[model samples]
Target: MLENIRENSQGLVAKIILGFIILTFAVAGIGSYTNSVDTSVAEVNGEKISQAEFEKAYQTQRARMAQQFGEMFETLSNDANYMAQMRDSVVENLVNQLLVDQASRDMAIRISDERIKQTIREMPAFQVEGQFDNNRYLARINQEGFYQSSDFRDYLRVEMTRRQLTQALVSSEFALPYQTSLLTTLQNQKRDIRFATISAKQFEQGVEVTEAEINDYYLANPGRFENQEKVKVNYIALDVNDLAKDIEVNDSDLESYYQQNIVNYRQPEQRRIAHILIEFGDDKATAKTKIADIQTRLNNGEDFGELANALSDDTFSGENGGDLEWFEAGINGEAFDQAVTALTDVNAVTDIVESESGFHLIKLTEFKAEQVKTLADVKEEIAIAVSTQKAQDKFFELQQQAAQLSFEFPDSLEDAANAVGVEVKTSAWLSRFGNAAPFDNAKVIDAAFSDLVLNERLNSDIIEVSDSLVLVVRLNEYQAANTKPLEQVSEQIKTILVQQKSAEKAQLLADELLATHKAGDDISAQLTANNASFEEKAAVARYGSDLDASIVREAFKLPHPVADAVVATTVKLNNGDIALIEVTAVSQGDEQAPASFEQQYSQQLAQAAYQSYVEALREQAEISKRENITSTSQL
Candidate 1:
């Protein structure tokens, strides 16, 4: 079960820990916590949520975010709104869990130990070859840090019991047939429309931005005219490839390494054997009697090959006169191997021996003694491998020393570089998105900008660029973010202003065309006179991946029109053009399920109902926090 939990429930383990922590919240009142605990963070009913538990959950969440966001973790961690939302979510999760526990007690929900054991046994992680293995279950549980099986089972019991209650609350809720049909209809609805675009570029000849407009726009949007902050850095790196070139291996060292790892080059002893078996299954006595009769034939000097071919119950080997070709130990069963090895005389049959396979008679045909390669034969290969291993070891050792030296003398990388025997390399100016060799690592960039490294100008903590490399950097020069001068950005701002004016003119003309077209005027002719053509799209749906998506979206939003009536709508396209669309016909989709829509709708309805059920429980529960506990304030 523990193996299964580790394999499939890595994420669920954190959730289970959260559930356990929440279950610790008060059983009765705050007074009980006041007398019984000083380290509790919150109290619900009379149970306590410990400070340690809250810190664990909070730290786990932070670490998870750090892994997911990398350098972005620093920005998100400093966000006040994000932190507050995270804290509230954690607190509400605890509250909801406590309420569920309370509900479970009120409803007297229970799970039996036998059921839990069966569940554990059935878990894939605990099974070997699809059957439960007790040793694997025990080893996995201990490896996962669950020392006591009872506690692990109890933890699972809570989850199982809660799931049962959750299913009971939500499983009955399902979408009605009419509701399902309506959803399917809307999802597959199609509209026939005609659309024409008024390109923004068409107005470019007439639209112009003056110097005053450019100045006004630049002043209004100062953020768009800012220069990026840049920094140059000095760094020392330890890479295995660089170290490997300097590594040298002597013949003595190669021979020593090979001698110590000789087992890897030695082949195991092997034996070739022929055997016959009568398997004991439903009728053990009958199988034993049959094997005894076969052994009597061996004693009577009957040909073993003929006897095996006619009488041996082992099918595959029986056809070939029971010839089990060369195999090493661990291949055949222990009992069979022991019996076969005991027969020292060549081609001599052994007495009937009982094994897991029932009864067997065996003869050894050929044997191969274990052999090892000579030092001369593998010396060159060993030397190269030995050199590589030594180099990798030296790289890691030097990296560690460099990391320590940088911290002990944070002002410069000189001492650290000399200690690691590498030169301090300087980089060109780097921005947040710079991709120069080692600076391509986000960790290196983030550390270079860190407060201690950037502002205080100290050596960075060792940044692991890859498995084979580690880097330590210090800022050499800093360029604070500043705004570009008005003169320098004037032309860029002018182009933006001109484009904005052009798009506005296009939208205005398109709107005028739409108004005139809706009032029975020939807008297509008017657009043709204005150097634009009306394009027709047939049977476009609300959710299609095509060029007419924008027009189709706007057309569907308009109310359905009567026979001979056209519905006019205008939509803005991504290319900064305005599309004037006219819907001529509307069609409802057939009332039929699309694949597994029924099952999907049922699941969504059940989940929504379950969410509501949980919310209702939370609303009714009495919850409190320990005033003295502040360490877990974020949680």
Candidate 2:
């Protein structure tokens, strides 16, 4: 009976038994009612971390990882430590999700169906032309293997609730001003210095090497000497675009589509306006006074364009007399747009409007009223849209025909092609692992390597390369692997020897230069005579430009720069030039910062603190996980 219970524990019968036992005890205080209920794997909190749920989550994670890494998945699975790490990661993620669900229940954080709908409507993926596309949304959901919209919506709701809980926890944490200021200062501080480089190329002209040494090096590295095999293949590719070009759209179709979707052809109302913007200074009262003075000037008949040219801080627009040039509604902030749109007359000046940028006085120059476009105006667009639809439908028909052909003549490519009214084409000699011509599809390559093609002269099954077309291929011939003689690689070996000798000579010269500089000997004349230039860098902070940041970090660790004392630094340039640098100076910058900058810095620190707090919470949430159960297991 115990063995049977263990085997059937994942079935619906076991769930019914467990449910019956709980209900029987609750109603009548029944004791020892069920001998078949296996509850040993249940959690201390009375929540069943069902074997099925664990296996599903585990398999999902495994498949995701395998898809991401491909062939490397096998290598990763072979390692015990890697498997353990993956298991732990999956378990942690499952536990966090469970904890989020518990927290949502405890806090009564309800996500409404309407909110989920609104969220989906707002999502850019589901939107077409700035509005939610119901067909596109449904099609995308269907493609993801969900049978119903309600199921997908429920998943989205759970995710949204989890996100809200995380946001709440983060918002509750506070960061201090002092911490913000320190971080801001660190972020903004810049470093300034002077340095010179000694390159390997400068000393490489004198280096010499023998053939015996090169031959010995090559002998020691046989694997590196092996050449990779390459092959050329011939194939007829069937791409969707190819079929789309051949598909035609008539005038009637275009006109019909344009009439059906008229809203898509209408343009929004737009306005052309100019403005005189006055930004607030440090003090609000003083800034307001300055703004009032600007308003008085505008009222007293001062040219708005001339005033904007003089006072506007927006460099891009200021040059053109604050002309923002044909802005549509909602392009600018709501306040600015409302103020601009309120002006009925072309010469009318707007009253002072306040925004984050500052107070703004505007003038309406010109406005283009919205127009519902005629069929002629959008003929080209309509034609393209209609053509695309026709092409898709034709492609679907072709796929059906090809599928039929494949069914009738499963063993012959020629017979299938004859049935579909298309010519049969043969591919050039291709190896099992060779790249498929034009289309590097794994499916095509796998078809080429199937037992029928590799060992027997059997035609490949119809392989759908893409949405538009299917391919049926038969292997023609095969090529055996070949190795090149050692004599063929002798020239390559000679070039390698030359580069090695050059690099060694350059290193020796760089070492001597460093020693000479350390001994307080002036080498600037020698450096200048060799056509080398000195680069002066300033205020390069830790997270500055990549090159300067790397150099600065290394230079600061060295002793203070002194006259004739060069701190030699070797860096590899992207152009294959090896640079050996001499550090001339290094100095720390001032650490004073503004209050706003400090606040921004503190926000970043708070985010990091919140992440650490969440990780701690997840660790404290005790979770036990089971694995390898069948789909029949119930929660």
In terms of lDDT, the best-performing candidate is: 1
lDDT for each residue of candidate 1 in 258-367, tens digit (9 for 90 to 100): 99989878876766777777877678899889988888888889877777788776544566677766634433357766777776656877778776556888877777
The TM-score values for the models, in the order shown, are 0.68, 0.51
Model 2 whole-model lDDT (C-alpha atoms): 0.65
Off by over 4 Å in 2: 1-48, 55-88, 99-165, 202-438, 449-451, 454-458, 475-485, 525-533, 538-568, 574-578, 582-607, 618-624, 627-635
Expressed as tens digits, the lDDT of each residue in 65-175 for candidate 2 is 999987567668778777767766755566666776777777999898778877987999877799665445545676665434555787898889988887777666665
Predictions in order: lDDT: 0.79, 0.65
How many clashing pairs does model 1 include? 11
